[model samples]
Target: MGSLVVFSPLFFFVLAIQMSSLMVSLSQEGFCSAPPILNAADSTAQPLYWKVTNPTLSPSHLQDLPGFTRSVYKRDHALITPESHVFSPLPDWTNTLGAFLITPAMGSHFVMYLAKMQENSKSGLPLRDVERFVFVLHGTVFLTDVSGVTHSLNVDSFAYIPPNSTHHIKCDASSTLVVFERRYSYLESHYTDLIIGSTDKQPLLETPGEVFELRKLLPTSLPYDFNIHIMDFKPGEFLNVKEVHYNQHGLLLLEGQGIYRLGDSWYPVQAGDSIWMAPFVPQWYAALGTSRSRYLLYKDVNRNPL
Candidate 1:
């Protein structure tokens, strides 16, 4: 005689429920041989997750390996990438980080940097001897001048602090600023004053061929040894000619992508990229892609060759 074992319907139901739950857990953990189908229109569907193939790198870093940069340095020019820089605190500054883009070490007489300031941060004191130009990239800032006047600045706003003037900065909100500093070039009976304005309010000067437009941030007067300009180019626009002169330039691409001709080499540049064109280096630019390209250009102007 043989003995027969029997299971109840309730036991089979419980086993099926347990198997379904295990499959769901495995699928959510990316261990399932087949993933559950997701309804495209179902707004309440549970979000799916997948295990990273490489546990060492994050999602963002998985595509870009460490220690790789598009920057290049040459005898006459240098192309600097945002990844090539390390931010550090500067003297007389608190709660701020600065990445110096161009400096005397790069054969630039002027120092240019991109500064990030946290809310409530302030510049320690008024800088001495050096004239400074500050451009607001985003958020709000207040500039207190020698006369105890505090000027509120917003995006696209800029301030020119004259040499030997008392000027301090306080960030009203988290802000990004482009700062340029250099010694004032002394001239007889000529003086520079603290000027404040916004680039959006400036009139755009279209080129003769209408290829591009520019807005002069600083006055063209001789008392100012340096000049800053914002150049805007529509897609497919380009400079009319290759420019080669005694003037040196420190340029920061503000928006869009473009191809820059520096010396004899051509480099692809985009927002956050910086270029330093030394004296007599041939240079030109052409806008690429679908959007407009814009850049902040700084040049040593109104000064005689020494």
Candidate 2:
């Protein structure tokens, strides 16, 4: 009986080990609890960003991670690398949407995408109530309206679509395009005609020697609540002043390197960088490298007081 008691504990330990191994195997074979369903428990299945905790951990009031100099947005965050890009394939089209600003997480009003579409891929502009702007970054984007008018936009080309317009976009060659959309709001006497232009073809206007002078893309006559500019800065030149404005700006750094003074902080930005600066957040920038610095700029303007 004494020998049996000693062996009994060993036998039970072996049995427990076997049971653990079986449970792990069963879990691996999909026999355990069901995994979280995509688009079931939350609006987004994958975690988009890492939360910040300064000195405390709280769900209701998380902080932006340190590394910013001084920021107006307590919720400010940035994706400093290309791998930080968030892309999901559109279900309707095989093309990919590299969305940077999505929904309420984005400030105020715009849905932006760095879209990749191959030749013969088609996409429709926002139909009834949305307006769209497409800037061709590489290759060819062919825009055709319902009236049969077609516009072929190449590298550095831009187009504006009005609200309620029946228009479609086709990529004749595999291309990368930046698509920006906003809800259409019009004022009486709003000049609503479509405009097409190219940064390569248009003469650089209103710029003084190597200074950052931005030439406007859309004619001021158009009643757009927003404006776009192809801005330039010579090497070692900066905005030259600390300024704050009521306008929010979206800047896509197209060429060269620079220092951006945003929301009371300084950041070194380079080509292919996209920046979103909220309205009234103090900002400025200076070109750093030997090459001329350039960026495609978007500014919200002419809106009634909130």
Candidate 3:
């Protein structure tokens, strides 16, 4: 028989305090149980973990633990969160860190990545025969174009670099940018010019749904092989219908919370989430909270299926 060992009241109180401290530590480390999912359509519902917490975590630390993630990968679509991003070096990029979010390996026709550049860092020689688009997410940068004109870019500023262009990027401050690149698909007697603009200055085009709007980032002309657009949805608004289209998309949620349908599954998404949809994949989205939801969308355009 085991003997009864009486513990003092002081000892019990100390033990309770220790346990509480342990729980707090675990929660900070993201090892605690996830909170329950809130009702997607209830505007008054409390924000869930995916919406309120920082999604960016060191990839090395996440490797050993079973952490909660909304990210999913399928044959036709994928949802990527910053927690899974692994920063790596790209050739010719000096003092810059990059994490590729979409690539040909993921069955996408283009490559998109998040790049962080230290002050004075530069993106070296432009790729031969490839077009590039850059959107500034933070800080400032100076882009020297093929024509040797330097343009300053701040948050929300974007530039489209034409194919085989001799251009380079220099960080004026510590900066973060979203970059998209692909081989240019040439159109007979057509050519693309370098474009620079700020999203904030673009006029919004109202959609059939009064709550939805769009800002076209690139010219809608035969000379351009692809296009980027900013789509905004007011609170409680949703796509009129689920869409199944031939356009492959690489989208980055820029603001607010929403429920996104990719193929047969629906996911709760928020700012900083990236989604990739292969051609003909079914997709839709609805803004869930009180704030508006906006995303940068990319699709190949003005091209034949052949």
User: RMSD to the native, candidate 3?
Assistant: 11.7
Please write out the lDDT profile of model 1 over residues 1-306, one tens digit for every residue: 899989775465446445544544564454423343333344124221111111111224324345656789998899987767668996789888888988889888888887889978887553566899998876789999999999999877899998888778998678888889988889999999899998888898767765788899889998999989999989879899789999989998876666788876767676778899999998988887556688889988888898
* Residue-pair clashes per candidate: 0, 0, 0
User: What's the candidate order when arranged by decreasing TM-score?
Assistant: 3, 1, 2
Candidate 2, residues 78-138, lDDT tens digits: the string is 3232324556764445454545443336565766667777767878557467777888876
So what's the TM-score on candidate 3? 0.80
Query: For residue 236, what is the lDDT in candidate 3?
Result: 76
TM-score of each: 0.78, 0.70, 0.80
Candidate with maximal lDDT: 3
RMSD of every prediction: 18.2, 18.6, 11.7
Off by over 4 Å in 1: 1-63, 124-127
Task: Please report, in order, the local distance difference test score of every candidate based on alpha carbons.
Answer: 0.77, 0.62, 0.80
**Candidate 3: tens digits of C-alpha lDDT, residues 127-228:** 788899999887789998877899999878999999888889999668888899998999788999999999978888867644688999999899998999
